[model samples]
Target: MNIQGHAALVTGGGSGLGEATARELARLGAKVAVLDLNLENAQRVAADIGGVAVQCNVSDPDSMQAAIQQAAAAHGPARILMQIAGIGTAKRVVGKDGNAAPLDDFARVININLIGTYNAARLFAAACAKLEPMEDGERGVMVFTASVAAYDGQVGQQAYSASKAGVVGMTLPMARDLAQHGIRVCTIAPGLFMTPLMRTLPEPVQQSLAASIPFPSRLGKPEEFAQLATHIVTNTHLNGETIRLDGALRMAPR
Candidate 1:
């Protein structure tokens, strides 16, 4: 479907890949809504893009529902949903003192990354299904964010890896389930990128991580991710797939 004149919802639009995506969508002439837990950040992006800003908690049913409603009120119902809001953690399953990893930590990651994705997709699908189908009977498209850690999680990444893996695992099934509703689902599992969190690391550490990628020898750009995401919407045949945007980089187990 053409992005021009369509309404789009971007979670985590406050910063990083989500922010880049929101800007790209707006640039493509889509009516964009920047949704994030941080209202100030969302507002900043929204103002710059001339889009709406919605404070949202992806894992909370009421919060997500309310956000969607608010966004729709501003920009009409959205046909594109970018599920990108998530958190990362590095916690060993067994600490140096030999205690088990806290269940809360694992739960928090799963709730936000995995369950939150489902929440956003389900809500978006429900609303999109009711919309008049566009070309090829397509009502909407959804792009989910995952990570290379899902496939090759290093040490101290059990919670983060598991949550992302769940997203990867859900891609095909969710796409199939939404097929009848005329909604497409796909995932992007990215490798090391220069996100805010990654930038906090020392320069040498960042360079070391970038060197791991075989070619280009640099971190993936947020705009690269945004480009692929928008392409998925335009390319109708691509569905139920998890495309790795990692520039031929398979992570090593640490």
Candidate 2:
């Protein structure tokens, strides 16, 4: 489907991959809506791209509905929904404290990453289903963000891994279920990327992680991820798949 003049909604569009995708979509003439928990940063990106900014919590149904309404009001119902808002907290299931990690911590990650994706995808699809189908009977596309952790999580990442795994697990089923509506679903399981969060780590640690990749050893640029997103949006045949954006890296257990 052509991105030009279509409405695109990107959660976590304040920074990192979502921000990059939003910028790219706008560059391609899509009407972009930048949604993030950080309204200030979302506003900055939205202003930069001449798009709409909405403060959203993907985990809450009401919050997501409000955000979707705000974006649709500005740019019409989104035909491209990018789910990227997620959080990861490193805590061993059995920490040095000799206790299992708090269940609330686990729930928080799942709520934000897994359930949040579902909330946004469902609402976006509902809106798209009402629209007239585009050429090739296409109505919309959804690109979800997963993690390499979902498949090969090291220690101290039980909750994070489980949440991401749920995302990976849902890709095909979601795609199949939405096929009848002319909506496509796919997931990107990114490895270590030089996101703002990763940049905060010590240089040595960052370098070590980069070195772990087999070849072209470096962190992935957010633009590279955005490039893939653009391709997925345009490539009509691509659906129900999880593509790994890693540089030949298979993480070892810590």
Candidate 3:
């Protein structure tokens, strides 16, 4: 389970937590592949990290398969997978105008956040299962991203929360299924973090959000998340668990 000198794949590596993870893995001596929907951003991170950039749509079968193949072609088959690519939306089941929320919104979020996660994991696990086992019969490890909203969703977050909750739900079962292949699966349900999307909010709004955390009363850092993710890879005994990276912050209903 040592990360050094192994091949790793990070989806959504263009920005935010995924970018931080890609850099950290590279720094730790893993040959990293940065996979993202934005080729430009992926390339930027890949170049800086001396890794390969792949344009990937995790929800698309062909795109995800091609991306895995391309990364293997460059870095060899990856034993580490970081499933971070996802989208979010906030919509009430019934809008202010008295119309039911568009079904497309809910479907889109589920497709990207939930189904997309499974798509990437299945392809990665299939390939990793073929690799020779490392120490302790471990061939690979994968970390999935979820959110605190999955546990306590605010108003108008039906789609976003459901999608993330699905990820949280999948963790233990997926781990159990892959255990036979010497592959481990875990999830991280992060609280508020200073991601690109969060940065778009007004400063005052951001400050208010930060103050909501019970202690340390500030948004979580991307590097912190990355650190935990890398730790999960090295700690062989940890598997089938969902670690919450929230700073003791149970979100209030909005």
Please provide TM-scores, in order, for all candidate models, with all chains considered together.
0.99, 0.99, 0.99
lDDT of 2: 0.95
Global lDDT scores for all candidate models: 0.95, 0.95, 0.95
Candidate number with the higher lDDT (1 or 3) = 3
Give every collision pair in model 2.
none
Q: What is the lDDT of residue 58 in candidate 3?
A: 98
Which lDDT tens digits does candidate 2 get at residues 29-72? 99999999999999999999999999999999999999999999
Root-mean-square deviation of each candidate, in angstroms? 0.7, 0.7, 0.6
Please give the distance, in angstroms, between residue 201's alpha carbon in candidate 2 and its true position after superposition.
0.7
Model 1, runs deviating above 4 Å: none
Q: Look at candidate 1 and tell me the lDDT of residue 215.
A: 86
Per-structure clash totals for the candidates: 0, 0, 0
At residue 193, what lDDT does model 2 achieve?
A: 92
Q: Mind giving the per-residue lDDT tens digits that candidate 3 earns over 1-254?
A: 88998999999999999999999999999999999999999999999999999999999999999999999999899999999999878898998999999999999999999999999999999999999998999999999999999999999999999999999999999999999999999999999999999999999999999999988899999999999999999999999999999989998889
Residue by residue across 1-254, what tens digits does model 1's lDDT show? Answer: 89999999999999999999999999999999999999999999999999999999999999999999999999999999999999999888899999998999999999999999999989989999999988899999999999999999999899899999999999999999989989999999999888999899999999998999998889999999999999999999999999999988988877
